[model samples]
Target: MSTTLSPLIDLQLKGFKVYEKNLTLQEAERPLLAAQIFSRRDYYKVLLLESKCVLHYAHQRLELDGGQYLFFTNPHIPYSLELRTDRLHAYACLFTEEFVAAARSESLHQSPLFRIGSTPLFKLPASQADYVRGIFHKMLAEQQGDYPFKGDLIRTYVQLLIHEALHLQPADPVVQPNNAATRLTSLFLELLERLFPIELPTQQLTLKTPQDFADRLAVHVNHLNKAVKQVTGKPTSAHIAGRILDEAKALLQHTDWSVASIATCLGFEYPTYFNNFFKKHTGVTPLSLRRKD
Candidate 1:
């Protein structure tokens, strides 16, 4: 039987004060609020907002200014932002594995761009940021406008996001070669890319164990932990559990799945155990989050 995994990037914040705020920014000086998601999955979805906000990432943060960019990948690799401006205009678009296939020939699957073992997320510097911004803005305009070939154009812009990101670097730090520890962490990250959607936290159906994950990858548990920690600076269990809770929140907010059923799907042997686990992770009962319509 197929297990149900959690959904990545659950953005429907329940009952937050921000929900009642304005969503458009026509003002000339409105700041930008953006967050780029870097994930373990194959999809990349960037959120471009017109207000100011913090950029959410796996381990770090970016303070967004006017008309900023936020990139995302699947399995919700840690990214989000809290907008500061009064009005927020944002467009979120998703590109799947199709992007890679469309970008390169079959033989180049192993190329550096598509390599599962390297960094998958990159942010544009201020110098080149405007170019990328224009591409994405054109995309948003195309999406909002009624153009005959709007769909095709949107895909083209999405392609540009990836292409441009690969070339853009941070302001103060330049990317360097991967060291032994970095290599190990990169391998674990690659493993997450492969394992995430297949063992989706939302699906609730999965082995749900670090040992099981290590076994599936044919690596020792300690070795895997070392590698994952070295690269990401977070423990393997932290990623796994966080991914699970993310989907749990998504489903709890979006679906009518019974808590017991959701729990079982997430690999808890008993509903009570799942309940406790949920409480421990979220500090609130599952029903509280699910109570909203």
Candidate 2:
């Protein structure tokens, strides 16, 4: 069975939460734990896992042997965790952007450690892991207290955690070929995935065409198109159209936003253009799809 964890709902209920688990009990005494799949969230997460597990994050998969590792994720990326051993011990802190407002230098989502395509996993040395564990213990203890300024104190702890991870060396870069097609294709995909989950109706997609993406990737349009096609077996325009179509369908089905609003947010200059595009690709109008739903 699979489970979808939504931190947005949790953060709406409580701006912040911290928890820990130690699953070292004997097999007969242990409780069943299912793999957790989480979609994009509007909050940030900091996790320390001391277990053997496979982490599927965005477009990358990481197999972590039994050891302490610090992981950071922001609102844009989705990830899942599958435990490989019964000796799972972990601590996690989840908080909305407002929870750390006082401590942030800029949007946490834009930070290098949490930004898309940047490495967020760091293997911790024993000494650093012990220090990190102590910080989590403090967070847990203070979370139960009645101090009026505890919220401020907790924010400091969260900032400290970010600082600690920033000081540590990140894991070796995932090995990929130096070939231009492979590298360009990987960068193109990451750039494409970054502009997603359009959480607010006021938010608008800035890069809407293959040329737009190619410009941002700093290669000629033809170069990007050729490389993407060579590596992914599809033209760049096809991929862009496919992603936009997926997001359009998702918004039409899951959201109450009007067609005009959806069109504007999706970078369409006019609703008529959006209507034609959607119908041409899906053989149904956006409104029809919503009404059918």
- lDDT scores in order: 0.55, 0.78
lDDT of 1 at 81: 54
Could you tell me how far off, in angstroms, the CA of residue 275 lies in candidate 2 after the best superposition?
23
Q: Residue by residue across 202-290, what tens digits does model 2's lDDT show?
A: 99999988889988988899999999899878899887777777678767765789999999998999999999999999899999888
Clashing pairs in 2: none
Best by TM-score: 1
Candidate 1, residues 64-158: lDDT per residue as tens digits? Answer: 67554545444335344566666665555555555335444542234333344433444445656567667755765654454555555565676
TM-score to true structure, per model:
0.63, 0.60
lDDT for model 2: 0.78
Off by over 4 Å in 1: 1-43, 49-52, 58-67, 75-78, 83-89, 95-133, 144-147, 169-184, 198-205, 226-233
Best by lDDT: 2
Per-model tally of clashing residue pairs: 25, 0
